[model samples]
Target chain A: MSAEEWEKVLWKTQSYPDNHIPARYFLASLRKNPNFRPYTYWPLVLASCAITQHLATIYIFLAVFVRLKECSLDPRILVWITVACFIGGYLAWELLNCSRSDTARRNANGTKTLKSSILVFLALMALSPVLKTLTAATSSDSIWALSAFLFMLNALLADYSPAKLGGQVRERLTSVLSMNAAISSSVVLGSRLSDGLAVFALILFSVQAFALFPMLRQRLQATLTIFQALLTLLLSLLSICLTASLSATVSCIYAATLVAVTFVAPGILVWAQKYKNEIRGPWDVAVPKVN
Target chain B: MDPLSIAMITDFFHPNVGGVENHIFMLSANLLRKGHKVIVITHSHDPDRVGIRWMLPSLKVYYLPYPTIASSATLPNYFTFLPYFRTIILREHITLIHAHASLSPLGQEGILHAHLMGVRTVFTDHSLFGFEDAASILTNKLLEAALKNVDAVICVSHIGRENTVLRGQLFEKTDEDPSTVAVSGNVFVIPNALVADQFKPSQIPDVSQPSSKPLCVTIVVISRLAYRKGIDLLVAAAPRICSAFPNVKFVIGGTGPKLNELLQMREKHLLQDRIELLGPVRHSDVRDVLVRGSIFLNTSLTESFGIAILEAACAGLYVVSTRVGGVPEILPEDMISFANPEEDDVFRAMSEAITIVSQGKHDPWNAHKRVKGFYDWFQVAERTEKVYESVIKSDQRDLWTRIRRTMELGPFAGLIYVVILIVNCVFFLILEWSIPREDLHFVWMHWNRDYFIELSQKEARKTSFI
Candidate 1:
């Protein structure tokens, strides 16, 4: 039979057998990698900068905890630094809002932020005494292990997307989970402190690092790729310097991890693009477009 | 062709009342009529449906006592199925095993074990699946391993054939062009066929009857309310259709997870009177529902074969379906209307169908006659018999060839499945020793219509004499 005589319809009885492979266009509707968009090395590295920033935050939090735990750093000085970082972060946030020309809700947001900050400060002061002795019964080794695992969980589950900013950016469940994990790690580590003030200072620093810093980072991610890369570099270097003062081996490990996340991982991804075979066709479940 | 002792192995069968279940029953009945023996092997339904049973016209069903994980599919335990499978195949004298539905673990395991019994194997994929989803990726690998040594593959439609070919990796390098691959020649496209007489058009009254009120052009939708069935499109389009055409009404049947959404659409739009929901209509009542409306609307996002649309068309209702998988290949262009699976497009198609229906351009009885000739179960049986005959004539793959073919799956998965293959053979050997073929009860006699009737009459006369 001629190839033209073989129509794809099922209702009719064509002379060809049921197993006939058409001489032309067999399995013609199959579309391989139809929506393929290959990733470039540099662009993927830049996109993965969010992961680098998240890892830096986690490492910096650990360094702060280690300093407070060993009683080597003054809690009062740490609290003063937290206050200064809070003021500076607030100014930067205000600047971001002004540049986006979102002044209509500025007064409302400022008052709300002021109320929440004061409430958290007073609450932390009240909770410091209880938190300092919260896990006194648990061994120090268990506390260290738990905090390490929790920090890893926070890094793994954190929301790394750039926020649109200037709108009600609804928090994702994963981001909430990530925040809780980091705060829980901070509490367990703070409970290992010798004094209540150190616990208070560490808790305050954690609230800034885990909660406030992520929102600021998301807004900053929208600014420029160069800006994000520079911030990632600064944070990673600070984490390495702080860890080096404590231990050389830990600092080297952190540096290697930072380099892997920022450069090596993205290179592997760019190389792995050749293996991506996304077979799409009419057989895929259609996403109905509704008004 | 000589008679084949064929075992229809699937996880779906009677009392389940689904497309696969009905297809197996109908095909088995038709094959029995054609003088071949057919037996169904499926997981037993809950509450008292276990062991061997018989349907009309000598379609024997063996409801194996196996629990299903979800959607009536047994867990794919590679070796455990061999003991039961071996005993059934040996006793029933099954020369070939035909498995249905890719999701059925019983079917895949049957294909994996059939070669060990020295029986030829044929597999039919009844649905289409995307290759990108994680579930599809894992299941497709499993399917690839299961289909590696099967004698033949059957698909319900052309699109389904493509999906199964890719999912099963049923392709080889072409003879002329070694660099290019083609779908294997053994893969066949045998479409699902509906019994048209069951969907015969009723004697619907025309405008000439002059009843108390003028008849309205009703649109009927009969499908399970599921996301894949595109119920969201219906919920979006129903209100707009209601306000656009006041005389047009809807009768939606079948119930599923999306039922609440359809109910909410009806309530929010205040279309309670305009839209009627017949919760869970039986298969026998589908034709009655189809005959109530002049237009049959199907809004499925993905369909392997639109059997519902064919049933509607056979019942004389003009079909207006979302132009989806294998649906376009089912009927002639004039008999149905197609729309992209979008709200505006479906609304457009629905309005056009309404106009066509109201203007009397589409005739129901004429459509019934046309569709009646399009598909028949007996014809499906004959074509399937051709596949079975060819499969039996083909050489069965040896254990070494099966191992080599299984090795082609990939490095990681291929090694894993190869281990499974060897382990399965060892287990079969163990079963052969424990439950030897000599001790197994063989089915020496089958149901013969004439002999059974004569035996029954003789018993009746003896009872009367007593």
Candidate 2:
């Protein structure tokens, strides 16, 4: 038997006391590009549009607040503008729903129905008084801390770019943009009134945006275009600014903060997220498909 | 020797309650009972001795203050932990680094650092990972790199061995040396053992024969309602199973994203009367819950060792578990009914188990005996210690050079052997002919091997005296 045979090195048999070292030691046992899938540039650009719209809306809201603070404008105009925008969004959503009734039907099959959702929303709205009163027992500092914690949680769990129905590009873009707008709407409403109604509205809108919209947005992204998204972003920002300028100094500050937030936050967040997870180790629980 | 200096490294231990954590604690305690110096290294949790903690006599634990990454896994800092690890090893005179949990950074880092420091390393893969998912990919890569110089790799079950071989890519061939990477130690099937005394038939609820009244079969489910746990399967099967076995009741414990889905199932099936959704319970209370139920239901998609099912068997509850991971190997066929990780299969198996129990086809005592035979912490500790000793003995100087030469053929292959080794060695030979040998830095060995040998002999004598 050849003591220096390569097989001896491979099996490391003590029977063969050959000093010959084994080859292929650097071939570390690991999956080569296990879950890697390349991204399409259009999809990436379309996904970025949600952030763009959010920033534009924030800018508009600040501009309105600035006008109100400087020109001593009325808050009624701001409210009217908000209502008008909500109505416009609602109408647009309905139109989209009608156009894609078949797709909506498919999505709704294994999902919650509109009727059940409405009932749940109404129930939550009724319970808002209790939720508002919940913080009454606690101190303001505690509530602040709690809200901040919840916001951080929300940010962490929330899906940034959701998929579309049947991988439609247009539909996916539309849904994501709509979801972001919905989140913006919730933030504004959340900041506006401290009462039960405001709280309920914020909760409702948050669920709609974060939970439901992502699924719809994923469907929409497979269909929508970058141009349409840009147009939507521009128009929404202009409308928000036109209305927001009529509000008070506090509202203006809130508006300005939103603008400041959207512009710088995304860049900062993406940068920070890079170092968020340093998942080293072959020992990690492998994601298996239980067949 | 010298009290058998050992370090048990894991991500989830003590304060973090789960099957893996409980296993670690039990193993540590048993090792300590066997007169070994055991220390647990884990990420620091708030309000729990952040640095060093002593659980029991001769059981010293070091809680490293590291940021938790995801689900208790600490953010992996490879080189940053060198200084602390080095100091700990030196202070404790650690002879073996026995790491637990596949994904735990503490375990991975501990094993890697320990090997570099010339200490024996043994890694116990407590969980099974598939060859899919981004997390698994990264984990596998890191695990591969870390296990490069590992003394031995322990799998909980035979299936786990196959998975380790496949996903870990343990078998390969190369030009410099084409061979199956002979692990210095064996890939032993060390199943997770439970404390049989604590979990016994006496501890469980009285499962006398089917009463005159409706047969009250409480199906116990204590698992995190995650996708991996097959919570969705449980939701799909629970109602149907309950409907089929009218007298049977369900108690689902633990919490996750799938909690809502389970609740919806309960409501949809109108199983509120029969099924109880207990979100989460204290680890101490798990045995109590297991005993209350006549049958234990495990719907986990994958597992290295089904510790819960083993615990249930110890509790004398007829085990009905999904045939995933190392569950099948853990128990004899008579003790438990295995089901595929599907809703239909799980429901069917559960129904069959209920039927059999109602008919009094099997004896719970037999299960208790089998479980006791199969799973005992003392056996695990003894076997583990043997592995440690074997590895320590195998870590000779000759093996190190051979391993390094073998590893060269893996990544930076031909270029290294030809240029670095052959050419350099030739150059050195020629230079020796031209110039005189130069003085080099003389590094002293940290621990005297003779001292450890002497200590081991003394300990053997002490054991004989006892």
Clashes of each: 0, 43
Model 2 score (lDDT):
0.63
Q: How many angstroms is residue B294 displaced in model 1 relative to the true structure, after the best TM-score fit?
A: 1.5
What stretches of model 2 exceed 4 Å from their correct place?
A1-170, A174-291, B1-3, B172-185, B202-214, B396-466
Predicted model with the maximum TM-score: 1
Q: What DockQ, between 0 and 1, does each candidate earn? A: 0.84, 0.03
Instruction: Assess every candidate by TM-score.
Output: 0.96, 0.56
Model 1 C-alpha lDDT per residue in residues B122-157, reported as the tens digit of each score: 999999888877898889888888888889999999
Candidate 1: segments with Cα more than 4 A from true spot:
A2-4, A100-112, B176-179, B204-214, B453-466
- Residues forming the 10-long window of minimal summed lDDT in candidate 2 chain B: B437-446
Q: Score candidate 2 by DockQ.
A: 0.03
Q: Tens-digit lDDT track for model 1 on A182-206? A: 9999999888889999999999999
